[model samples]
Target: MSADVVAGWGGGEAATASGKKTLWWRDAPSARLAALGVVAFLAYLGGTWAFPLLRYYRTPLLDLGKLLDHGVRGGLLYTAAAVVCLACYGLALRIASRSGARLGVILVFALLFSATLFFSYPWGAADLFDYAVIGKVLGQYELNPYVVTGVELAGEPWVDYAPWSDTTSAYGPLWTALAGAVSRLAGKGLLANLLAFKGVALAFHWLDILLIALCLRETRPDRVAAGVLFYAWNPLVLVETLANGHNDNIMLAGMLLAVWLALRGRMLAAMLPLAGAVLTKFWGGLLFPLIIAAGLREQPRSLWRRLAYLAVAALLFGGALALGWAPFWAEGQGAWAGFRLQLFTTSWPLVARLALERWLEPARAMALAQGLALGATAAYALARAVRVRRAELTEASYGLIFFYLAFGCAWFQPWYLIWLVGLAAASWDRERLGRAALFSALGLLSYLLYHFVWFGWGLDHFSIDGFRALAMAATVLPPGALWLARGCMANR
Candidate 1:
């Protein structure tokens, strides 16, 4: 594609009235869009800096809770700020999609966004605190975090802040060991440890950006800037990975690297990073079958050759897992305990359980709902896996993850959407990208239902059922309506 076409100028050339062709950067509309994106970044930065004032839990470092009086006013202010940030993110994404967007501009803005959030308090979730406590358990006390719960280390700083204090480490051994190393480097300071973990996440977040760009360049070269911007500027990704300090970015980086290598025809070399991703978080394992399918496409039509390929792939994958687990294997035999704790109902599953409770016992209702979700997810995965081609692997992975998050996941979190957004951006599927963007905005918005509506509005009669109903509507309605409208337009 020519520069003008790539820049979204539909004609042969973008020329001035003086009959001189204008450069893309010098075009009036491009400059305006760039300026608007800059303004959005600045606005988002200010909002992140202000997050400390809305902190839910008191900390010795700073206490700005009184600024909003820690009541309904505070909640409403938080809701407003979140809404503005998401709106700004959406606008910036629109600007990035224009093909006129420069990679340099996107990279600079992404770096600034990550840096600002790196210093902000994790107001959205307490997962960072849990990570710090687990790190302390393993690093400071020299205990196996996978075997010992944070609750056992009662007096440790930040232990009280962890929501899952009674559970063992839910993350994979590789993440646990990395967290321990970060904790050891940071020493005994609470703030230091927290920032250290965020710093690691920041590094991985950038790695993910690089990997996303490289993958797009390999598969969808024309969309590199737009695709990178899609994942980099996503509000949910920023808040969850950078500010909240979730390790999902690390997992994503490994997955992206695997995809990049596989796209370049190094299918065997991709298995190591794919294994690393799974060892970072179990969800990364979902892509294994997809990768295998892609690998099979590259193999010659011979039973012995395909068998040899499968054996080598499995050996690489299993060997990586074994090496990652070897250090903690002896004492961390109960690591699966943390994974089991993550199986509680939320989102769509919660809605299902609530609806079924009218006719059956509560436990039975939940069991039935979970079973149905599993069955549906398994069927979808099988169908997609069977038809996946090497070129369509990323899109297939995105579709499976999107479907699971929508209808199967028993415990859904907003950060989980990062998985879908990352793959969708790589695939560069317009409809999937649109849906991912919509879901991201809505997922962030759903926070208000918990932080404000349920608590701030003084709705004493509000129940989990009410929250589930509103969350489901907020998540499902907008995208469903958009999909229907697009179908009607196509038919017309």
Candidate 2:
């Protein structure tokens, strides 16, 4: 109504608003990083998809000559992909000090696009044939996959490439049911399991990124975009969940949704998804104690109420688990197979074998090793929570996550990192993300090495020790040095 108001809206105040943005946003490091993050992520997805397809298939179309050529070509592509993931990571960090959310968005779209293209490819879908085996066991013959192995149905060209095809999933019974249905629907056709299982994994992986972003937003609105970048563009998640084909995606999505619900004070709504998650991955059981601890924050509720609520939820999960797994219990003879000596999916099992051989008595070796490893892990988790109970940072709870992920003596797979990727991203600081990103990329080596180990070339698998050593140095050294500069402020 006033001339001054009109002037302010049309000219003078508008100028002030525009100037303020140039000063804070354009020059703002975080904003720049956020924008770049989105671009880099999409680029990573694109660059990765641009490479060779790693699917397992027995195409009558390709003979030994073709096989050799494809292998050589695939090798180069994977290497280039690794390089691309790393380069983008560097760019992300350079811009991270400017714009985390923008960077994250870039990274997310890139990685997702990369994964999408990879799966959609004819060759890329080959690696997923093993799932078809499971489907055949369930769909065609009505036999339980837990009771069978891909090796049993090994007539296909694709099964040759699914390194873990001979191995059973150790997945929750219900997951097998779903895989079987896909196989049945595809019906003894070529690449049926591959197409179906990959489709499921693809759906879940997308859901995982979206849910993780939502959880981060709900709990720490400041870090939402960054969390999405970390999970989506993350090399480990890409290789394992998207490429190698892991089922952890669905399980983790459920877990993130549960966290979101609980954080929003809808604890009751959280329980179903949490229980379902546990059924998908037994590791979800760890949330019981953490949730219990979180509930203790309110005055007058006390630890007893916390434990009681946890018990209720545990019972809730336990009941669902019993029902879900009851049908497959008799079929899961190898259910707990391959679950020995795993530690952070690092080199723990290797270390354990060497250590046990030197000192422990053979009669007592296995039991003692398992006990000590499991006990120490649990103790560390409890200790960490107690120490950080007063810390203002919500990400501090990651101590428990890191500990659990590190304890087992099984072989490490890359996408397993997705479990904690969200936490790391939500709390990501100006420190270089390149190292962790490198570790994520090297995880792809597991695919190549897995083939070597399975066909009786465990010796050859370790031949990459030279590369492993280099990768370790590259992934850890820079970050370690950066920590010294800031006194490692993550806790603060």
Candidate 3:
């Protein structure tokens, strides 16, 4: 694709005639469209506030409970909320594309949306409860979270809400340590602890936004708003980061900082945050080889500079990894034991096992599938980085990161898409952005399984079997259709 299409500017007329495009907030029609997006965002918040669906079964918020008491109507409100988020996301993209929106205005609106959603009740995912329970295990009981399962904390009051009774911590040491620190600060109060964790997630959320903005402004100054809003105003990013409080954003903050530093020509300094990202979540570690390739992609004619860059990157990243792993090392196991455990045990291997069950044992099938996917994605990424010039290095990295998350990872979660949000911002590819929006809209259906099948919080069990199929279709079909259509278009 040409730069125009990749930068999401082909359909919209270029504004070079005026020396530079007018910022969208300064334009009347685009500003009005942004106002409408704000209204749509408010509608989303209203739906969330009115019908909080994921309230803990043990400690129900009465107002939210009363709202959910309406059965199917409450479920409909949750769906409506997802739709509103989708609408706002689409509108923001249009405003940015057509009116040349300013990054500052888009950021202010994003921060506003994030703050509003942050305070709203945690509505759909139950991951936050697990985060709290694990943090409590570490902070209050002083146990090694890596070794102690929530089952060991069976007697603890907070464990009542944590679902992973027999499951060890699946996150990285840095994440666990940070969660423990937050747990200590919040003490034993459940609400206070939840808020504290959310605050940390929110801070990283903003940090991810800032890094994305900086990276794009440095690389593609003209497409700043498109890239920034692609990430900052992404509905999936907002919902997952602010409301769900997933640690994926924390991982991305480190990854983005590393990539942003690299963009600024500070290749050595980039390795520190890259290592931090690895410690935050091992997924970030996968980018190390790619970053090395990009660093070498620069100074292609100068072998010594390339070798020096690689050595420094290796030292900085490796040292940081060793330091971050010190806690796990002290416990007599590799810090990455959690990743190994999750690989063998979790539903992350479901797709692989399901596809190859007849040909191989479940374990073998899963291992083979994951290995192939990850290896192929990594090899492709390395080749791209080796070929691309220094200027295109970041986008190449972002594209590979998006591919790795979409296909390389064992399990797919809605929040996992947040990893792509920053990359999408950097690339500003219309097709990529469209598919992301589609995925965000469809991924919301996962909540239906929560509401209807798992808990039946708002709906009766009248057509429970049918509801499961409906939920599956809602969650999976849009992306499949999108891929199919795109393939056909490419062929034609």
The best-first sequence of candidates by TM-score reads 1, 3, 2
Instruction: Evaluate all candidate structures by whole-model CA lDDT and list the values in order.
Output: 0.76, 0.53, 0.68
Give the poorly placed runs of model 2, Cα more than 4 Å off: 1-56, 59-80, 93-97, 100-108, 120-127, 150-168, 296-299, 302-308, 331-346, 361-367, 385-397, 406-409, 426-438, 441-492
Predicted structure 3: lDDT: 0.68
Off by over 4 Å in 1: 1-25, 53-72, 330-342, 476-492
TM-score against truth, every candidate: 0.88, 0.72, 0.82
Top model by TM-score, which number?
A: 1
Q: Report the candidate with higher TM-score, 1 versus 3.
A: 1
How many clashes in each candidate?
0, 47, 1
Question: Candidate 3's error at 251, in angstroms?
Answer: 0.8
The 10 consecutive residues of candidate 3 with the worst lDDT sum are 1-10
lDDT by residue (tens digit), candidate 2, 27-56 = 344445545545555555554444334443
